[model samples]
Target: MSNPYSEQLSRLMAEYRETQRAMVEAQQRLRSLSVTETAPRRVVSVTVGHGGRVEDIKFPTAAYKRMPPTELASALLDAIAAAQRRAVDEAAEVMAPHMPAGVDARALLSGDVEASSFEVPQSGVSDILRDLMSDPGK
Candidate 1:
């Protein structure tokens, strides 16, 4: 005889296993994620990897050599920023499906999401503590 409880348990286990597999795959993809961007003046290019860290930088032209130190630094910063933004967008896309509903993956990847926003109000904590401290038999 086919047991209904066994069937349900089997289905649930299968779902759990699938979820685990998908999450592993997503993490692997995220680990390999990268994005590249170039400065507007084409003086510098930057490649950003996971966590928005710069993996590589390139100067496509000798224009940077003639530019002032501040100008060159600005161009490098701009390219890095652009690459980081694109990397965050890509990471958000990869992570959003794995995250729970209403979670903003883009904001999270960009470091703009606050942990406090997810906190639940403990309005009854004091009351509960007071009740616990009082004599129950009274």
Candidate 2:
């Protein structure tokens, strides 16, 4: 006995397979992308791969020699954070066109797409200034 619904189910399954293939390809491309960011005064720099992995880090010779261990550690942390933020921004930008309308790319990259769509949050000037003034350690 042939079921009429069988054909429709097969077609749906084929479509799902194609979509999954495309998603895998997109993830591969994203994994190859890289972003680099440097801290203020060129004291520290970091590079991050598309998979959110840190690829490289560099510190100025003078900065490395002059700063105490704690300060150096703090600077490195700050540089890494800056690089991560830049990497996330880059990922969002690359994924924007590929994403569905109203989808948030950052959220998608963060594995938060299930929770919410992509929406870039705006940072105020005052907020930036306050962060700049605050101690990096704290």
Candidate 3:
């Protein structure tokens, strides 16, 4: 009889290769999309790209002269968070059309799905690595 284990390993490897290609393409697509969010009163705004990079920030004149420093800071932070959420959503929207059916690109992009869930851990690699490397493993 043929070795079924070999066939299983081959299939697993093929799946892994496909997933890697898909992820790289998704990342590239994300880098191309952009999203922006602004404060409720339009005093602050932030623009972010699909790769979660901040592309720009805008502050209205009134924000600098009328608002206290702490309030201005708070509004900026809120706008950044809003922009990040929009960026993630936009990234998902762009990726949705390209993704395989039933795959949740948003969860993967947002890191809600752990990479470890898909791969095996090698104790040898961890045991021999620096402490800093181990921190990322957790």
Candidate 4:
């Protein structure tokens, strides 16, 4: 007779391995992520890398020099913020499928919540193992 429990376990294990592989791929893509944003009238441009780390900035034109110091600063800040927001949005989209249902990838990346708060549920694992061992044919 076929062992249904064994078949189920094998299927689950295969799924787990596939999920791990996909997550690794997603992480690799995120690591290489970069985004650039330019402020109005090209006052400033900023490039951000993974996790929104500022990688580069350029005035792009003489317009920044003509602006007041405060305005220039504001333009730089705005460009950097826009770049970071784009990076976070792209990252969230890439990671959404790997996250559990109802988990907010954007909120997590934006630092709105602790990663520990999204800990994977542990209930099914133990229950499945117990059932498998208790009944090989179940």
Candidate maximizing lDDT: 4
Off by over 4 Å in 4: 1-5, 119-124, 132-138
> Which candidate has the highest TM-score of all?
4
Residue-by-residue lDDT tens digits, candidate 3, 23-105: 78877876677788888788887888866788899875565568888988998888888888778778877677665555676
lDDT for every model? 0.82, 0.72, 0.73, 0.90
17-125: candidate 2 lDDT, tens digit per residue: 9878877877776788787777766777788887668999887556677768888788788878777777787778767766766787887777766744335554444
lDDT of 4 by residue, 1-138 (tens): 867666778888998899999999999999999999999998888999999999999878899879999989988998999999999999999998878878998998899988877767676668888987797666
Which ranges of candidate 2 are over 4 A from the true structure? 1-25, 111-138
Candidate 4's displacement at residue 7, Å, is 2.4
What is the TM-score of each predicted model, taking all chains together? Answer: 0.79, 0.59, 0.59, 0.84
Name the weakest run of 10 consecutive residues (lDDT summed) in model 2. 116-125
The true-versus-predicted C-alpha distance at residue 63 of model 3, in Å, is 3.1
Q: Mind giving the per-residue lDDT tens digits that candidate 1 earns over 22-132?
A: 999988988999899988777998999988989999998888889999999998998898888888899899999977667899997777888567655454445544554
TM value for model 1? 0.79
Error of 3 at 95 (Å): 1.9
Candidate ranking (TM-score, best to worst): 4, 1, 3, 2
> Model 3: how far is 8 from its true place, Å?
20
User: Using lDDT as the measure, what is the rank order of every candidate, best first?
Assistant: 4, 1, 3, 2
Question: Runs in model 3 with CA error above 4 Å?
Answer: 1-29, 118-138
